[model samples]
Structure formats: C-alpha cells, structure tokens
Target chain A: MKKLLAAVLIAIFSISALTSCGQGLSRFSVTYTDVFDTVTVITAYAKSEAVFNKAANAAHDELLRLHKLYDIYNEYDGITNLATLNRLCGESAQPVGKDIEILIKSGLEYAALTDGKLNIAAGNLTCLWHDCIANGTGLPTDEALIKAKEHISYKSVKLENGTLSFDDPKIKLDVGATAKGYAAERAAAVLEENGISDYLINAGGNVVSKGKKPDGEWKIGIQDPAKQTGEYRFIVAVKDKSVVTSGSYERFFEYGGKRYSHIIDLEKLYPSDRYVSVTVLCGSSADGDALSTALFCMSVSDGKALLKQKNAEALWIYENGEYEKTDGFKIYE
Target chain B: MNKKTIADIILVCSVVLIAAVMLIVTTVNKKNGDKFEISVGGRVYGTYSLSEDRTVDVDGLCVVRVKDGAVYMESSTCKGGDCVKHKPISKSGESIICLPNSVVIRVLGETDADAVI
Candidate 1:
C-alpha cells in the first residue's frame, strides 16, 4: 500500500510538471509587404507556432483578397476589381462582387455621415496627388486641381443590385482612406474565427486588437507626427478595440522648400494643414479610419459631433506640438 | 521514514524545483530583448545584436547602422529619403520602413505594447 501511494504521488508530480511547462502563451509574429501598398504585421499569443501560422496565413489571405478588390492601380486577370469599375462603370453598369459592393456602400455611408468631408469620389484629385508624390514632382497646378475638384461628388457613383455605375464620367472612386482599416478589421475577424483570441493587426496606420495579452491589455503607441519617426508621443493600453491615425507626414512632396501633405482639403483644393495628425479609437477600424481623416481635415470643434455620433474618441496632434484628446480617450492612456 | 517514501519526496521536490527554474528563465528572457531584425521584401535579411554596434548594407539598396544600442538607416538609394530622415530606433518593436526600396528594420524583442501605430 505504501509503494502504491508513492507511485501515485510521483505520477501526480510528473503531471503537474508537464502542465506547468506549457502554462504561458507563446508569442508569434509575421510580416507581409505585398498588401495595401504598405507593411502589415500580425502578432499574437498562441499555444504553438503552427497554430499561429494557420491563423496568420488565413488572415493574410483575407487581406490580400480585400487588397486586390480595392486596388485602383492594378487589374488582375478575370477579376472585375475597382480599377475595372473606375474604367468601365461610366460606360455601363459593371458587375460587382459582394466585397466591392460592401466597401462602396461603407464608403458612401462615411461620405454621408461626414457630410462629404470624407469623399471617395474625389479620386481624380487624389490620383493627381498620388502621382506627384510617387514621382517626387511638385504639387499639381491650381488649374488642374480645380478642374478635378469639379467632378468630386459622392452622388455621382451609383451601386444598384451588385452593379456599379457612374452618373458622371469624370467621377472616380478612390478608397485609399478606408481600405487599410477595413482590411485590418476583416483580418482580425478571420483570426477570431480561427479561435485565436489574443492578436493585434497593424496595417500601416490602422491597428486593430482582438483581445488582451496574457500579461495584460495590448499597448499601442501613437506616433509623433512632427517627428515622423518611430517615436511615440503617447502610449495607450486597450483591448478589443481599433485605433487608426491619419497623418500628412508619411506621404508628401517638397516644392519650394515647403512640404505638401497627401490629404487634400476640399474647400482649399489643397492639402489640409488643419492638424498634423488625428487618431481615432473605436470598435470598428473602418470607422476609425474615416473619422481620423475627416478630423484631420476639420477642427476639433467641428469633429466633436461626428465623434459622438459614432461613439468614438479622438486625439488631435497639431504641428505646433499642442495636443487634445477626448475625455474617453484618456482612459486608455 | 521508509527509504521508498523518502525517495518519492525527493523526486517530487526536484520536479517542482525544475519547473520553477524553467518558469523564471522564460519570464526573464521575454523581458529582455536586445536585438533587431532586418527584412527586405518581407523576407528576413538578418538579425543583429543591439549591444554590438555595426553598419550593414542591405542588399546594396540601403545602409543600416547600429550604434550605442540604437539602429538607424544611414542612407538609402530610394527617393523621398524618409527612411534616412527617420530617427534611430532603440526600443523593441520599433521599426523604420522604406516603402520605395521595400526595406524594413524592426527591433526583435518583447515590448510593452504589441505594436506601435
């Protein structure tokens, strides 16, 4: 009987030892450069590398699909992507995929919500800025900007019965502002569907978190726009939230020693300098992305109503280094 | 006590000790990240210790310099020069990316936050 008792104790100790070995969650990360014209990094805590890789790859595939669907520059074979819609929608109603339809509808919703402050139909104006930024050329001529601005109206693009058409031939759709955040949100959903609870998806300026880390909540650092470096101006802890920032510092052109931001102001027909950067934290990354851009174009007072409508919080960083955050945003900080 | 019972007690205590040591080691290692990884075109190019300062040429596309436990892009053969203009990054998880050249230099240690946006 004594021998039996000893044997059982040893077995119990061995089992405890084994269980303790696997107690803590392991951290895994992967990076992709081919999506959304920017670097995407996915980090998570999981039981094993194999498990994380399965979920990460699935999330990556989803992002790639969204990237191709929303692409405006490249046209894939047999894919009626956004570029195709932009080219042929004016000629006739183009058959659209569900993904494109949803994205367009979401873009329109944001356009309407912001009262046209976040217009995706300003593709003509945005494309001009994109070209100048890519080629390191000077800013677009005032005459050219004004001409493109003439066609900037959200009502011109029509989506009906999974078909997209343009009432105005000059009206084009550019979803650059919301595509990354929307993709990030979708990728996070894929991770959650794979049973991965603790993960963070950083798609360039858009960050979406699904759950808290083993140690505590996930921490996110807001970049200092004036520095344009990896330095953080503030660090916030959060869980199950999406944080998105829009800044003019990342992509810009220099002309006559003056920097021109990529975000254009609708009223000025020029890049807006209202704020150096605007960051929004909310439940959906897509909403955060749109609000960040809209807030960057408008003042804090003008954006308060919009923020309250979406149940989101914001932090606006000015060029002079002054900053302001909503009351709720301070909770995470 | 019987010899067999004494041996079982010793065995249980050693197993517990080993588990404790392992837990401590892993926790300590996770807390200290003093290295950075560099990648080009989404593939890892190399990893360098931040403690050992050195200069690395990234596929003849750019120059990366690690000095005083901080890493920065010395020069790049791409337009915009944003990577070069970026400040030296010493914190774990901080990265400097050159989009035109598809070069990324990211610190590869555990950080306070999972990511910086």
Candidate 2:
C-alpha cells in the first residue's frame, strides 16, 4: 500500500507539471541590422507558429515602409512630398494617408503641450544641425540659429481637406522623432488583431507590452546611466504598458573634455544639459516616446506635472545619479 | 518486496522524472529563442544580441558596431569615450550610452520584441 501511494503521488506531480506548463509560450523575432541602424521585432504567442511568423513578417514590412516614408536621406519621402507639393502649388492640398494624418495631428498636439518644445516643423533647425555636424563644425552661430528658427513654426505647416502643406518653402518636416513610435504602435496593433495577447514590441527606445506573462506580470529594467556595463539602476514591474526612455547619453560629441549630446535645444540650437534620461509610461508607444523626449528637455518638476496632466507616469534620472518619479509610477522596491 | 521489485520502481520513477524535465526544458528554450537584440550608437543601449555583429547610427551620434562575440563603442563625436566605457554587451537587457551624443545602446530580451502601440 505504501509503495502504491508513492507511485500515485509521483504520477500526480508529473501530470500537474505538464498541465501547468508555462514554457509552451511561443516566441519569434526578426532583426534588421544595417549600416545606418537596426530594428528588431519580437513576438510571443500561444497560437500557431505560422500565425506568429506572418505577424512578424507583417510588422517587419511595416517598419521598412515607415523608414522609407520618414528617412531624411530619402528626399522623396512624405515630408519632401508635402514640401514639394506645397511649394509648387501654393497650398493646393494633397490627400494624405491615415498614418501621416494621425502623426501630424499628434505632432501639433505635442507641440502645443510642450509649448513648442516638440515642434515637428523644426525641419530647418534639424537640417542646420545635420549640415553642421556633417561638416565637422559645432553648432551654428546664434545669428544663424535665429535665421533657421524663422522656418521652425508648427503653425505654419497647415492641414486641411485631408492634406498637409507648409506655407514657407524654407519650412520642412522631419518626423524622425515620432515615426518609430508610430511604427511600434502599428506593429502592436497588427499583433493584437491577429490574436497575439502576450507580446512586447520595442522600436529603438520605444517599448510597448500587452497582456500578461505566464508568471502574471512583466519585469522591465531601467538602464543605469552612470554604469558603463553590468548593472541596472531600477527594475519596474509592468503589464500592458508602454515604456519609452530618452537620454542625452545615447548620442553626443566631445570638445575640450566636455560631452555634448545630440539632442538639440530648439531655442538655443544646441545640445541640452538638463536631465540625463527620461522614461515615460503611457497607453500608446508614440505618446511615451514623444513625451520622453519632450520631458527630458524640461525641468524635473515640470516633467512630473506634465505626466500627471496626461494621466501618465515618468521617472527622471538626473546627472548626479539622483532620480525622481511621477505620482503615477508604482515603482518596485 | 524483493530487490527486483524495488529496483523496478526506482527505474520507472527516474524515467518519468527525466521525461518531465526534458519536456519543460524544451519548452523553455523554444520560448527563449524568439528574443533578439538591437545594438545602437557606440553602446548597446536596448535589448539585442551579443553573439552577432550589428551596426547602428543614431543621427547626430556616432555609428556603433557589435561583432565577434564582443561589444564596444568604436567611435563617437563625444569628447570622451563615455560610450566606449560600456565595452561590449554580452548579456541581454543591458545598455550603454554616450550622453553627450544622444546615443543609446540597449540589449532587449525575446519577450521584449512584441510591438506596443
């Protein structure tokens, strides 16, 4: 009887382990590593392998499509399309795609929210910086920056009858700041529509996660700004949330033992020295990404208040290794 | 109650345990295989592969390369090798940055690949 009972117990344990298998989750990822940049898409599902492959393929295609549309190197992209059409026709409206329309609307909204700190019509400023950096020169002179600022007005870029056009020929549009977020959002929508409940999509620094991990919640780590390698500053438990981080450390130039990051201050036409990094959590990846950039350029108090107003959350890492969290963030201890 | 019966029971239990463990291990590896890494700038900012070579350019920042089972910041416009200090990233979910350049390097996990809108 004793032997029989042991056998029964073992059998039950084995069956339970099999039944509660958490490892059955299927995952897929595609990496596009190129000379200019790299983008990777990862998907986890309990559905068919074919379905996951199709979803990943679709997401990859969409990413490439957006890259073509927004890449500054491609002068024939949507921005140029609008610029040329506006110059030749003088505000004779041209029909735009839903995605572009949404982006323009969101861009205007963020510009208003940041009081013009997040202007998409600052293409002249972007071009000036690009030109200066390419020529191995520092930021343009104050007079030159002011001249460039003349074309950096979001209000001048008008939208009507499902069309977008710029009033000034000097005015240009660069969606580099927002295109990745929109692409990420679109990829997530594609996965969710295909019945992928458990997945995470990260385009550059913009990340969005949905559904629940088999263990119930997802674990995300915030990078340590001071650490060169092998340590995280914090770990946050997230679920169905999008996390986007913007930091000055990611890109910069050095001069006379000083580091100058690539994030330009539109007002100064120079790199900023505000917060080191800003992480935003919100419902949409695009919002999180855009807000992270905008908030990083603002004061800590102002950033927190902005997150509060948006009903979102943020964590700001300062230069001195100090950090601040918004009221909305339920940071893990 | 003899030695043969006891030995038979032990052998059967061992077989069952091994089979169960193997099933679990296979499933876990399958789930993990879906994850990949994207290295950017001179540092590995977000989640990405440490085993393969990857090159990325972050606009105003310098171009970064990850190759030959190591990660390093090859070049940057930043004053110091702040990004180079990050070395090469081998672990997932690790990152390096050149703050002055606005360049971010990250190592994302497999589950991190899902798109968030």
Candidate 3:
C-alpha cells in the first residue's frame, strides 16, 4: 500500500510538473536582438539562474548563427547566403549551406501546400514594393508590377548537387516570412535538448511556448486589430504550442494618405487585402509563420480547404472588423 | 534499522528535497516592491525602483514615467506611439514594446543577479 501510494504521487507530480514542479527550478528571461531584425525573448527554467543563462546563451547564439547564414540582405564574410544565390542567379550552381538548402526545400513544400499563395521566388514584386515604399511613390505603376510577375515562379528554382540555380536571372528568393520563426523553433529545440523546459520564445510576432508556467498556463495576447493602440483582443492559455501573428497594422506606409500593407499577392501582383491580421496556432513556429501569411492572403474558404491537410488552427481578423476562427481556436471571454 | 525502514527513509528524503525546492523557488520569485527593467535594442539599459517617482529620458527620443508603483511611457519619437498608448505596467512579467525604437520595458520581482557577463 505504501509503494502504491508513492507510485500514485510520482505519477501526479510528473503529470503536472510545472504546477508543483516548483523548488530547485529557476525561471528567468533573456532577450536577444542580434538577428531577426526584431527582438527575441526566451524565458527559461533551470536549476540555477546562472545555468539558465548559460543554456539561454547557447540558444541565442545558435539563432544568431542561423540568422547570418539565412540573411538575404547582408553578406557576412561572403559566406554565400540567399542574397548571394540571387546575385548569382542563372549562373553555375554553387555549393550552398544545409540551412539554405533546407529552407529552399521548405519554401518549395509550402508553395505547393498553399498553392503558390506563399512564394519566396516573388522577390521582384517584393523588391519593387520595397522601392516604392522607400521612394514614397505609393503603389508601383502597373507596368512595373506586370514585369515583376514574369519572374515570380517558384518552379524556376533548380536544386542539384547540394547547390541551387535559378532559370531566370531576375529571380530572387526571400525568406523573411520563414526565417525568424524557423530560428525560434530551432532555438527552442536547443533549450529542450539541454533539459531546460518551461520557456517562451517570442521572436517578433512568432511565439512558441514550451511548457506551462509554474503558476499556471502561459497567457499569450493576440494583438487587437480594431484598436489603434491598447491591449490585445484576448489572452490565450497555451502550453507546448506556437502562436504566430501576421498583421498589416504594424508594417505599413502611407501614399496619398492611404496606408498600404507590405504583404503582396504573387498572383495579383499587388498587396493582399483579404485580412488585416491572421494568427496561426500550430506545433511548429515555421509552419505557423508561413501559414499565417498564406491564410492572410486567401479567402476563408480557400484557407480552410488548405488547412484541412495540416493539424493547425487559424484565427483571421478580416479587413472589415470581423473575426473568423477555426473550431479548435478559443479566445478568452 | 530494518530494510523496510531504510526504504521508507529514502522516500521521505526525496519528498523533503522536492518540498524544499518548491519553498526556495516561491520565496525567490516573490513579488517585492515595484522594480522595472528597461531594455533598448534588446539589451538591458537600466533597472529602476518605483518607490520614488522620476522621469527617464530614453536617449532623447522617448520619455518613461515611473510613479505610484506603475511605469508608463509619457512620450516617444515614433509616429505611431503605440508604446505610449499601452497601459502602465506594475505586475511582474508585464512589458511594453516600441518596435520603431526597439525599446522594451518589463516589470520584475526584486531578484539580484547570480552571475553577469
């Protein structure tokens, strides 16, 4: 009977390790902005704060390393990143790192999965939009967008012998949508492998919660769409989940007193005006990031159709102040 | 002592260890008087106690006010000023972030650092 009681107690403790998993576990948070263009916060739990910091540093450094390798803008010691791949477009297929290779492969998979709604090969359209925003010229001329459509095919990318090649020299690959969240997922794994659980990794809008807080669930706030400035629409109680939010409110530029979002539709060669914000709840941050953007660009029916293949849920805030969410998604009352 | 007694003692020791750990963690993280940390560009810039009210000039671009046990943004350089619109934070782990300036302030309990790099 004593052994039986002890077994039951052990089972209960292991079941809710975070709730009663107290004592000996030190929880702390560290922020790093060495990459991802935005701040990344990872809260960790360990035997000691010093031990937690050391483990957190390892994860942060790994994210920085991935950032340098996956950067599409800057050349770090000429290591041949995505930008280099684009600059060397249509040339001989040069050897690339595994990170770039995996990303390209994932890009291809997501392209097919979302039916080209998420395209990394539409750099021409994205670059033109960037230039338009920088020059404050508002929307690009139809001629420019039409020209950009020519080089917007993901199929033009060629993978051979651990290298990548593009059929169209104008083709460029942009991984902005996937890089940050992918880094978060990777870094979170490092923390878990190091036996550090009960963490929250918020890389910009891409957030991943590993375990519950000692007090209770991790409360994640969904950014309010209607309100220009304030608290979130609602808080979500989550554990072992990834919450990624894509919104047009934060990143926008005004041209002729009209605000334009940065997300562009490859098919229309213009900004997608379907949704103001889309939050994807999934197991992986990479999927959440890409799917949030893809679903934001699609109609609800189409978004729901594609989401059937994956075990992920989505909540969409339409342009007309409407809320649409999957059945599994529940926001705080 | 008998073998059964020794086994019972081992189990008791394990339970005590876990209970002691729980006590340490709860006491260590207990919410103390108001203290908040200010971060710029993802680095800890300063930590201020909220006992006395003061205005913090954040690099001449933004101003933060700590008064009445609550901290809030009084002004900022960003056009959106979302940070300014955010509510004052006094609870532990609450944060206000300004993306344009890359500023983040989080409220925390009074816990000294074990190691600094």
Instruction: Give the clash total for candidate 3.
Output: 2
- Against the reference, the lDDT scores of all candidates come to 0.85, 0.67, 0.77
Name model 1 segments beyond 4 Å from true: A1-24, A331-333, B1-33, B75-80
TM-score list, all predictions: 0.86, 0.72, 0.80
DockQ winner between candidates 1 and 3: 1
Worst 10 residues of 3 chain A by lDDT: A10-19
Interface C-alpha root-mean-square deviation, candidates in order: 5.8, 7.1, 9.2
Greater TM-score among 1 and 2 belongs to: 1
lDDT of 1: 0.85
* lDDT at residue A167 of model 3 (Cα atoms): 85
Candidate 1 C-alpha error for residue A182, in Å: 1.0
lDDT of residue A223 for candidate 1: 84
Q: What interface RMSD, in Å and to 1 decimal, does model 3 have? A: 9.2
The TM-score measured for candidate 1 stands at 0.86
**Winner on lDDT (1 vs 3):** 1
True contacts kept of each: 0.49, 0.06, 0.06
Candidate 3 lDDT, A267-329, residue by residue in tens: 788777788888888888998888888887888888887777778888888778789998988
lDDT of 1 at A329: 92
Candidate 3 accuracy as TM-score = 0.80
